[model samples]
Target: MLFEKTYGIDLGSSSVKVYSMIRNKSYIEKNMIAAKGRKIIAVGNEAYEMFEKAPSNISVSSPMAFGMIANLELQEIVLYSMMRKIDKILGIGSVMYFAVPLDMTAIEKRAYYQVANGHWLRKNRVYMVEAPIADAIAMGVDLENNEGSMVVNIGAQSTNFSIITGGRIIISKKIPIGGRQMNEAVCSEVRKRYNLQIGTRTGKRLKLVMGRLADQHKQARKVVGIDSVSGLPREEVISAYVVNAGIMNCVNEIGAQMKVFLERIPPQIAYHIAKEGIFLTGGSTRIPHIDTYLASYTGYSFNLSDLYETSSVTGLEKIIHDRELRKWAQPITQRKL
Candidate 1:
């Protein structure tokens, strides 16, 4: 008999995270693909390298957008490519657990099933696990308890606010705002203030370096970009204040929405959440003092998870290995269209 393998996969918009139960290791790669007119070129981190710098003939793009699978075909290709790299044996009878957004429609949920049942792994089994549930598990939240827990995941193109109680999700919402929007806001601020045209990647670097909310210490970083005024290449020193200004715009909006979301919760559940505070985990939450910043808006403390982008996959790892936690992962059955 052949040994079966199990994997936990989080197909995030910015990157793909996979955890191999057999290997007991996690893998992360940029969820990008580079192609030249239907011809395959590169995938994963290699493709990300050519993102802003690739020639006109070579197009680099992500198959996922806003935490959803935007292009099913390309998405399948990317997943298969990454799986091959992780393990050479694309053996039958393997099991896969995918962490998916809660707000996805039936059709959207089916897309995940399609990808798993696609050409590469037709004989494998697929399970669907809500992203927030996995995140909470990774954060060491006691989901089996009656206490309510709130989780916020800020990804590349979207932010998910979810409430979980008694091992089930109570309410969840996905907003089309996240790290991408923050990066754009940074670029926009730079253009308006210094007449410099910087790419989103540059803006991301600036955010990582200087994005602060509670602590507004002064800082600066030199960046190269196109001069908006002269249409020529130029280098400029950008202040942390400008970067913070742009980031706060998005953060404030999320906070305001979070406030409204919390208002609708029942008093009893709200009470538990108040005691436990909010469970925050995601890539965009990496900004310094962001937890403190959000605390001010919602009037609640936050427990920040250091797992960052890999929280969901890490949680899935536990679910796959532990029989008790496996109850949260449901098999994705085919739905008639």
Candidate 2:
């Protein structure tokens, strides 16, 4: 029961994915926590089920905010709860490989190290890997080559853009527009145009179901929401066009940032990006025609990862065994502790 093992932990704002080297499989779950007073009642998928639908006494939320650790205590609780569900904790010297945001500040990076080294983890064995690099590896890009490639991850709370060459990140940037913002925009637009106030979950459902390119299929769905005037629940027919328009602002923002990002890179790298096409990953990439929409705006083709959401963890799994990939790992510094 005290077997030594290494875990690849991708703790994102929307979900937590873990890749176990010993088990050779991955665990994926929504990164949610439901608390009643000071006590945590649930975590992961179970807590996600209660989001936006929990009783007044129970608070359901993600411990992370804007891709960084916001509530240290809550994050620790959620991390421990999840680890326990997977296997028994053996305490000290249990190696862990963590996928970290490339643009995070020193303090933010410290938060991740601290959480992993907290009581239940192996403080000295915690290793860090850049999230975007891991994603690129998972996508089958040869980071060791002299050629360059660009990777864009559209997460729940933030989007990360990285320019990579020679197995290292040359330039990386993060924007604060993601799935949550898109859902909020959808809710706001629906309320403005239809006088219907919808829940976060409902808005998200509509975005995924109807958010598509201009020429994509036009379908309609019945959406239930509270009427602004009556404050009573009512049903309204919402078309894909309306939903598409609602989330377009977010899509355009991402495109704008991409244009800016490309402008800053060297011409040689930019040329590589053009030939390779920008790689897209993360849960938000699943939105219908998102790549096409981004391509139209940027004037370059786009490539999407088949396992966008779990790409980082999958790459982490690969790193544990591949000596060349393991060279990218950065050991936790003593100064941070």
Candidate 3:
């Protein structure tokens, strides 16, 4: 017999996160193993622990690149592993709902739907959901009206800006600025100035510990990285001021994209957005001062969706429970040839 709960998978670049409802609350988990080489040595928290600690033979890599599936085979591997992992916890088969970027073409979207089905590996009963739309639906944005709501998901490799009107993607933009870009830019900056090199894991810690986009007035934290001049291990007292500089590059790029989104809306439609402004999600938005930066730039009040990290995944709950949303979602998996 089939299980009753509907599960959602947010197939992310660096890791895969799953969210299912358990007793009305969202049950979520993620794997840190970046897919590289022939095998995924670690998944989820174990992989997260191995991120910087792992040996060279095991290089952690993100299976997805630029908001699309770059490695189909590894994706299947990790996905199947994750599905089985979930099955172990639930003790039953699940109806799956997976989300993809808004700008994904018809064929590309279908490919993800197929991945959700796990056809090659033998999983089934898959449903496809758009990332942006699911995010809005979970955020409680009005779906029935043509007034429209914009969701900007700042992820690891790419930023997705989608406008959903009547619960569908009418216009959207996918830009190549995300969490990874920020880390790389910081690494580049430190290397150029200090001649110091660091790993993504180190860069990630720097970005999170003191990552900021606000002014120099705020209290800053001193962080360590490779020293440029000595070529020896070094530590520098980094002010949040210093880190903010690296983060703003991406924030500015996002602002520019938001401008494009603003232009795409007609004057009448734009008026409605003026009332609601834009909603921000994804892992990057969690950075300090990002929300304030966008608000200051656009002159419009911007709000961040609750659970910005799990918004897309948990949002599918609203999608499946409602008939209208289910209509927008097509079952691409488990189809007979």
Q: TM-score, each model?
A: 0.97, 0.95, 0.87
In candidate 2, stretches whose alpha carbon ends up further than 4 angstroms from where it belongs are 1-3, 89-91, 122-124, 333-337
lDDT of 1 at 219: 92
- Candidates in descending lDDT order: 1, 2, 3
- Give all candidates' CA lDDT scores: 0.92, 0.86, 0.71
Q: Over the stretch 1-337, how does candidate 3's per-residue lDDT look in tens digits?
A: 4447667778887667676554444544444455457555776656667776677778865567887887666677677777666555544345778887765576676567557555444454677777887788777787777576778888888888887777577888888999989988777666665567777766677788878667445655555666666767777655555556777877888898788678878887678777887788888888877888898887767778757768887777777666777875667643422
RMSD of each: 1.3, 1.9, 2.9
Q: lDDT of candidate 1 vs native?
A: 0.92
Steric clash pairs (candidate 3):
31-44, 34-61, 35-61, 194-228, 195-228, 196-226, 220-240, 222-238
* Model 2 Cα lDDT, one tens digit per residue, 253-304: 9999999989999998899899989999998888977898899999988998
Lowest lDDT 10-mer window, candidate 2? 116-125
Candidate maximizing lDDT = 1
Assess the local accuracy of residue 44 in candidate 3 as a C-alpha lDDT between 0 and 100.
63
lDDT of 1 by residue, 268-307 (tens): 9999999999999999999989999999889999999999
Error of 1 at 151 (Å): 0.8
Give lDDT: candidate 3, residue 145.
76
Model 1 residue pairs with clashes:
none
